[model samples]
Target: MPTGVALREVRAQLFGAADRVLRRDGPSGLTSRAVTAEAGCAKGVLHRHFADFDAFLAEFVLDRVERMDEQAATLRESAGTGTVADNLTDALIAVFGSVAVAIVALVTFRDELRARLRETWPAGVPVLTEAVVMIKDYLDAERGLNRVSGDPEGLAPTLIGSAHLLFADRTGTPPDRAAVHAMVTTVLGGQA
Candidate 1:
């Protein structure tokens, strides 16, 4: 929104502001005006860059998915370096943060945003799917190193499902790092 900032920068700035608002005030607080104000930009900036509020939300959700995918891709690097539970907890925290929960609430209540997202991602955004693949890949790598046993393909979904439950409980206190580690340990058959 600042002078000389590139389009990509503006987009990133807007998304960052939106994420902050969503984290602080939940989905209901996210609006073009709120995002612009948080980003320190004029209100027209969002409309000029995106077709409508739904379009902007769709783009925001897609951008977050892409970022999660990127983070998942890096899981293999941690395969043998730390406890599997620790590694998994790190990845899960990255993918299932407060912001993600807020986004889910937003899309669930907003038909236009949900429709726009489905138009782009018919398989429902692929966050869990991408995360499963990454977890499986990391598990496979660990299995090869003789650090873990069992079918990663089976465990990945279980872990993802548990993480979804943990993250979706926004009304309660979030699971702490110890709880995350414990869940990952249970999934890994005490390998942690």
Candidate 2:
């Protein structure tokens, strides 16, 4: 909010504020005014940067998706270095954290935001698709190291699907590290 703050810094601040509002108060609490207030900026800051609230929301979701994709991509670095279940549990935990859960919930409940996202990304925001790809790529890397036996094509979706369920159940207690490890182990046919 300070004068001369870089545009990227302002945008990151706004996005963080929006993410906090979404996580604490759900989609209804995510508005330009609320975001600006939370970010300690003038109310017009969001409007100045984005065409509209929907546009801001779309960009926020896309940013989070890119972050999740990056996290998933790191699995390649850990391949064969630890127990497969442990490595996967760490990745899934990163993917299903509070901020990601909030963004998913926000996009799901807000029709206007969803529609705006579809306008920009006709194939839909590539969060899940990209996650699946990253997971498969990691699994393939592990396979090459002889740490995982099965085809990643079959395994990635099953793991991701279950992770989705675990992530979607916001009303329930979130899964812990042990649970995530168990789920990954099960999906890998007890390879862990």
Candidate 3:
């Protein structure tokens, strides 16, 4: 039990270090040595916790996505009977904000690492699946009271994909949240 507890602690430390590295300097800043240095441990500590840098990066991305998923789940529960636009806007902001962009970069630019990561760890997919299901559930519930036009299951991915792209590009031009909300309102036919 003590060993398990210690391992969990070490994993948390590794994840936290990864978060700091990614947030401060983006994916380029992530290195096993850098993580160990931030974690105040020897380099071998990461190897013990993760298979390699790819595994570490995958866990880090998934950890952030899980955090975002939890937040969105809570918002979904609390915001009962809210307009789809409002709910989607809140959820998108919660799930796919600037920090999410950094995560996407971490996963996208490092393909070899990402492939290794995917072979061992399926990052971000489950959370996205849950989001889609939740949105579909919400739309199904609201169909009678709301004027939902398109299929929520299909629209959910499209909406999320758009946010993903916008985040990836980092255009720094459009008012992203508002524009996203507008798009959701138009595409999903819900009150914005």
Candidate 4:
């Protein structure tokens, strides 16, 4: 019988292979044979470690989400007393950078993975909704402080959609941090 250490080693190898396949070939390349080839292991090793591709994909996406959420939480905590733009920008950069691979995974499996995501990705909606609320709160607070002028409630969704589309774009160049800030700031001004 395989020892616990041996089992962990095998699972680690499989996850590494899966990660590489996801990165280099997108989500469609995650077949059992593909993973095994990447790992330089017997083809059956993948099935031994995971029930199937769906299970592996679900786990991998969930892992990425959890890691991203943790990073976002850290950024939110450390943003200090910076302007709303500064804090929000730092938090978004952390969240987006970590979840770039997961975003690609979602794009690759757009239709097939939605149900699994609904089940496993509970934080998805809440985090987004909270971000919008935070944007509004920042606007209100900053307006009170005279740092910004406008209704955040009206502008929050536009900013959210801008960031959403920025990452969703498969074009060779996605908007950089400055671009997003400029776009969001413009949206903020338009609400005035």
Residue-level lDDT of model 1, residues 15-91, one tens digit each, is 99999988887778888889888988877788888999889989998887788756766788888897888889998
Candidate 3, residue 56: how far the Cα is off, in Å: 1.6
Superposed by TM-score, candidate 2 places the C-alpha of residue 101 at a distance from the truth, in angstroms, of: 1.6
lDDT (0 to 1) per candidate: 0.81, 0.80, 0.67, 0.59
Per-model root-mean-square deviation over C-alphas: 2.9, 2.7, 4.7, 5.0
Q: Name the candidate that leads on lDDT.
A: 1
Residue lDDT tens for model 3, 1-192: 012233348888888887777777777888888887787777887887687788777777667656755665665564446566877777776666546666667766788666865675565553455556656666655554544656767777777776665555543553467777876776665543
By summed lDDT, which 10 consecutive residues of candidate 2 come out lowest?
1-10
Worst 10 residues of 1 by lDDT: 1-10
Displacement of residue 67 (Cα, Å) in model 1 is 1.7
| Alpha-carbon TM-score of each model against the true structure | 0.85, 0.87, 0.75, 0.65
Ranked by TM-score from best down, the candidates are 2, 1, 3, 4
Candidate 4 structure quality by residue, lDDT tens digits, 49-126:
677666666665655545554554544454336656666565555544444534554535655555565685654543
Better of 1 and 2 by TM-score: 2
The reply for model 3, stretches above 4 Å from the true place, is 1-8, 78-80, 120-134, 144-147, 169-177, 190-192
